[model samples]
Target: MTSNKEDYLKVIYEENGLERPVSNKVICEKLGIAPSSVTEMLSKLQKQGFIEYEAYKGSKLTSIGGVICIKLLRSHRLWEVFLIRYLGYSWREAHEDAHLLEHVAPERMIDRLEAFLNFPETCPHGSIIPKNGELFENTQLVKMTDLKVGDIALLVRVEEDGDLLDYLERSGIIIGEYIKIKEKEEYEGSVEVLQKEKSIRISYKAACQIYVEKRR
Candidate 1:
């Protein structure tokens, strides 16, 4: 498959297309492409039986498309783990290279790499790595925006955007860290969180992109 096709599948899956239809606007925004271009591609994917597309309602992956998407995810995430754990790359530096590598690497090489990495469960950004084309679901995850004041949660996964990753690293928001919501700005929707005794304010947009598990 072409890299563009793979990217479209990945974006759709990441946006939770499996659970519901993902709008053309969302796909266009994620890909930074024109709506007409996305429309063309979505039609192509639908005709090819990789997606189910509706004119205004958007699209979702079909079974075969999902299988291909999962395999690509497995390769991409495994590459991220290997790059960070063994190659001494920072978490923020691993994504782009891993994305490039995922499209070219063979399955056998990915299997060996996963073995060499001792089969890590997640990438450096805390997104789960699929195993044998299957993803182990995490049902407890909630968006960081869902937390209320005084609620504490464990940072689990973060959106893999370069600027967001860099901001998170600078703010000491690593995976597995415990964070307490100290305050909420009602007007703007930004939040103040206390992590390791230091207070940090994150924009609502940023909060929405972070995934956490509420601490019991």
Candidate 2:
């Protein structure tokens, strides 16, 4: 009866491979709740053996809860990709709609959808399918703003969860394109970058969040 379970579990699941604690404040922000509410739910979760919670510290899933989180996440992401690639929703609209349906997707439905979608290898945003109880390595990335004069880099990925994400997509910055900082604006921090056939100005804030690979 609570998204609290999936919410906490997913946060823990996401942070498991990262080298940092996703602070209670982060969970608060994600859920749009008071900090105290996060603490209250976390306490309940800890008692349920879903996570080990500490006051003013943070939480991590107990092993049993970890397995559930992984399983549910695999289902949600797989369904999201299926909906977008096969069912005609655009990439941007799917995450929120799928968020609701994903939690209730039946096991049989999941299997049928997977088979029908041909068992996608990756989600639309390019996240890998995590399975077989194996932890995934963090994706390789660097801030797009970090490109220096004459440094060659390719835009590898964009973090897809904010107001600015849609804005970036409309601006023609997407994954798998080569980009370089042609000039850094003196009045503002916009960087001039060239994609395929055109050059455009990208704000410093947007550039900083996108990950890029050094050309080698």
lDDT top scorer: 1
Q: Name every residue pair that clashes in candidate 2.
A: none
Residue 180 in model 1: shift from native, Å?
Answer: 2.7
lDDT of 1 by residue, 1-216 (tens): 898998999899888888788999999999999999999999999999999987678899999989989988899899999888789887678887898999999899999999999999998898898876789778899999999999999989998988888887787766878999999999989999998888998899889999999998
Candidate 2: stretches off by over 4 Å: 15-22
**Cα deviation of 173, candidate 2, in Å:** 2.5
Q: Which predicted model would earn the best TM-score?
A: 1
Over 95-190, each residue of candidate 2 has an lDDT whose tens digit, in order, gives 666777778887789778777878766566556556564447445667877777667687766655745556676787756678867888766677
Candidate 2 at 124: error in angstroms? 2.0
List the global CA lDDT of all models.
0.89, 0.71
